[model samples]
Target: MELRPWALLLSLLLLPSLALAAGKCERLVITGSPDAPPLLWRDPQDPTHLIGATADVLQQVAKDLGVKIDLLYGGTRSLALDEVRSGRMDILADAPLNLGELDNLDYIHPALVQTDYLVWTRKDSTLAYATAGDLQGLKGAVSERARLTPAFDTFATQHLNLQRLPTLTPVFQKLLLGEVDYVLAGRYSGMALAQTLGMSNDLIAHDTPIDQPGLYLAISHNSACNDPWLRGQLAKKMTELAGSGVAQAALQRNLERWKAQLQQPVGTQTK
Candidate 1:
């Protein structure tokens, strides 16, 4: 009879630990923008997944943490954010820090990469680009879904004449047609897309950066894996990645990868 009571006490002692173990996630699902190349983009051959520098970094992080991560293509940037916000996805592989998202996500420290947002203009244009203020009177175009630094976003909204298009291709097309004076885009992605569209000779990126934003991996607050241990481990690994220069190297490799894909015959280069 005494042994029965001891057995019950032992079961009680183990219940919490067992539940905690059950709660720990062995795999995490991630998603992000499909158009942000060199950083990330939809895998053409496998449209369900994303690939690029950020994908490589996340894969390395998953390897180090002994967890499986799926980098998925969850539609556009806004839709991907919705997926994470709803807890349908566990992580956003390449997210810029946003105050609005803080309620639904916990951004890891030491961002995966910092990219310069540059002003792209036509080769023959005489626009003197020194600062954001200089763009006040000129018409500009950017993707409707593009996110800029808070200060610049607000400045552009209040002081500049800008047009928001559905996608980047048309935005650049408008710039090429002289409908917009200039467009704002990331340095690497803009260069990559220009090459893809054969606008490399006509479009040029300004030397001065408009905004340099750090792209981070944000874990949904609702994720089962959003515990202190996982967040701490991710932050630690990201710090190491930032200092090791691996992310930059991956960016270069993927830039070339994207270019190489362009050279392959139409339907054959769907990766």
Candidate 2:
């Protein structure tokens, strides 16, 4: 048998790709929002762990990829971002797409979810919210840590009179007290927290959403697990999950699960 020189060259060129595809990281440690439910939240009964759609979906991804995931509560959003950014945590699930993080993380594209940031007002308020301009004169509050589209960020900064509260609970509280005319947050997430705080009936989300931004899983470039093989596989799987409608279904299911859990008596909320 005669072998061509081009065949040898091609085989050598393909070797690195093959090796990369074969490389696997044994464990991936992840952290995310401690209180953002439907997508993720700290288990009320077990503060040490996180549970919800993001957790459940990642568990499935781990099974498919044959990797281990350690999803734990790493504290507040800033603290969780710090841990993953520093490489102490391997991944940040439900991470918002931001320019700052691009330097330190490899973002999985097409995102696991895209959230609708709604304009929430007291049910009795007369704020007519059809667009961003309608919010100009109104004093508003947004969750201090909320991440929004760059366009909205710019628009709000330039035109909207808004303050940042620690979280949605207080933002809504302020709205009800008239400290702010409106509060902005993800529609479903705001609803979950509203139900938990027993204020679901008191607030109304404007029919129009303020912004819809994609939320992703970001792997730290500083992590030992952030190799090309793992990143590629993770991205591939995420795209599949998104395309198959699995991610949306998980979100829908968890929305109901979160409401049910939040609605339960204190003694029965957890198992």
- Give the alpha-carbon lDDT of every model: 0.89, 0.87
Q: Candidate 2 residues 108-165, lDDT tens each?
A: 9878787889999898999888998989988999987787988999999999999987
Query: What TM-score fits each model?
Result: 0.89, 0.85
Pick by TM-score: which candidate is best? 1
Query: Which clashing pairs does model 1 show?
Result: none
TM-score of 1: 0.89
Least well predicted 10-residue stretch by lDDT in candidate 2: 17-26
Q: Give the CA lDDT, 0 to 100, for residue 132 in model 1.
A: 91
Model 1: per-residue Cα lDDT over 1-271, one tens digit each: 4568889999999999989876678989999988888889888789899999899988988998899999999888889989998889999988989888899999998888888889999999999999998998999999876767788888889998989898789999999999999999888888898999999999989989998888888999988788888999999998888789898899999999999878989978564
Q: Estimate the Cα RMSD of every predicted model relative to the unseen true structure.
A: 3.0, 4.6
lDDT of 2: 0.87
